[model samples]
Target: MPWAHAGYADADALAWFAHCEQVRADGSGHEFGIFDAASGTLVGGCGLNQFNTVNGFYNLGYWVRESWQRRGAASAAVQALSRFAFDELRLGRVEIVVAEDNAPSLAVAERAGALRECLARNRLKLNGRFANAFVLSLVPGAPNTIGGPLSPNTALT
Candidate 1:
């Protein structure tokens, strides 16, 4: 539904839902949601979008509630998700394009060991304006993790 608010409205979340199902059927995209363990709230989502199973590549993006910033929640979830992609899913790579000005998110990406590839100009449209972006990725052995749920107390800020 968030994708609807972001622009794919007429088809509703059904479009994205179908997309997820198709990818899961064929070995590409997979959607995931982040939750707060203690509070039991849907904090945000993270997923593989615009994916290619043969190439083992997908766009990784995540959003945590504004209230949850700096808690290491994003990094932890990404760590688990990345591991799942590489190990269980046998992915060769997972790429993420993040807004350059989002320092905290960039830090989280770095902490998760995603390598910065480039600074993309006006890559994402937000509030009707295109913003500069940073491209990063985690390939096999990059972060070299094994999938699991977020362990907040063990996370880094």
Candidate 2:
């Protein structure tokens, strides 16, 4: 994933975790690791970040490990995260921006029931270069049924 860090060092992981904590602490966003329910293995990560506070929306992002790709992992994560955003965070909108060439993420967004909003020009930075992106969005009370609604006390466990 272009959005992922290039290194795999322990220090890098620690820094990433610390950053996640800071994000949560500052009320900017929250990030979570995606784990396989049956095996309890880390498969990917997802988050709600880049708050547009005035607009009552957040940017939803996710990535799945290569082995877990094509098996509904990304879609499931998107559904759960969006539900959490809506129900728990009380946010009014969630946006998924996928690079124009990133077919996998675009598919995940569509399958998760996010409506495509636009093809934003130069909307993404990938490997130090800019790229156009497709913007998709999810709103409250939409027809999305995957994973159902998250309960009041429930989180992405």
Candidate 3:
């Protein structure tokens, strides 16, 4: 969770969660925690955020626990969230923006069927500084299917 908590203090994290709850209640977007079904353990989180109403798309993000890395947890959660974005939310597209150097996250986006669009310059403000990011996208099509367990992962914004 270092990436997710990089710039935030405890209070900031708390405020972010509070805002997420409010957004969910208002139907602006959705946030979900990923869990292990058998053990009922929290592993990660995934969500649809940063709604672009004019473009009809949502930003998708997720991160797995250290122990859960390479276990397909993030991919599963992403697929579920993407499905929700297209089906329940009726959104046309979902974007996953990750730091260009973050290979693990880039792989997760690829596994979830996201297409790499471009490397945007100074696209994200991480911790305190700006960083480049790869903007991957998932649009409604024959290949963008959601069929996996619902789980959680760290998000970019």
Best prediction by lDDT: 2
Candidate of highest TM-score: 2
Name the candidate, 1 or 2, with the larger TM-score value. Answer: 2
Off by over 4 Å in 2: 2-7, 144-157
Tens-digit lDDT track of model 3 for 10-47? 88868868988898997777888888776777778788
* Residue 153 of model 1, lDDT score: 45
For model 2, what is the alpha-carbon lDDT of residue 11? 84
lDDT of prediction 3? 0.81
Ranking by TM-score: 2, 3, 1
Taken over the whole model, the C-alpha lDDT of each candidate is: 0.74, 0.82, 0.81
Encode model 2's per-residue lDDT on 33-113: one tens digit a residue. Answer: 887766678878899999887887889999878887787777778888887888799887899999999898999899889
- The superposed Cα distance between candidate 2 and the true structure at residue 109, in angstroms, equals 0.5
Q: Which model is ahead, 2 or 3, in terms of lDDT?
A: 2
Candidate scoring better on TM-score of 2 and 3: 2
The runs of at least 3 residues in candidate 3 whose Cα sits more than 4 Å from the true structure, single-residue gaps closed, are 1-17, 142-157
lDDT tens digits, residue span 1-157, model 1: 2342455565665775687688778766678767876666767677777786566588877778777767777887788778777778778888888887988788888887888889999988876889999998888864443345567543322
Residue-pair clash count for candidate 3: 10
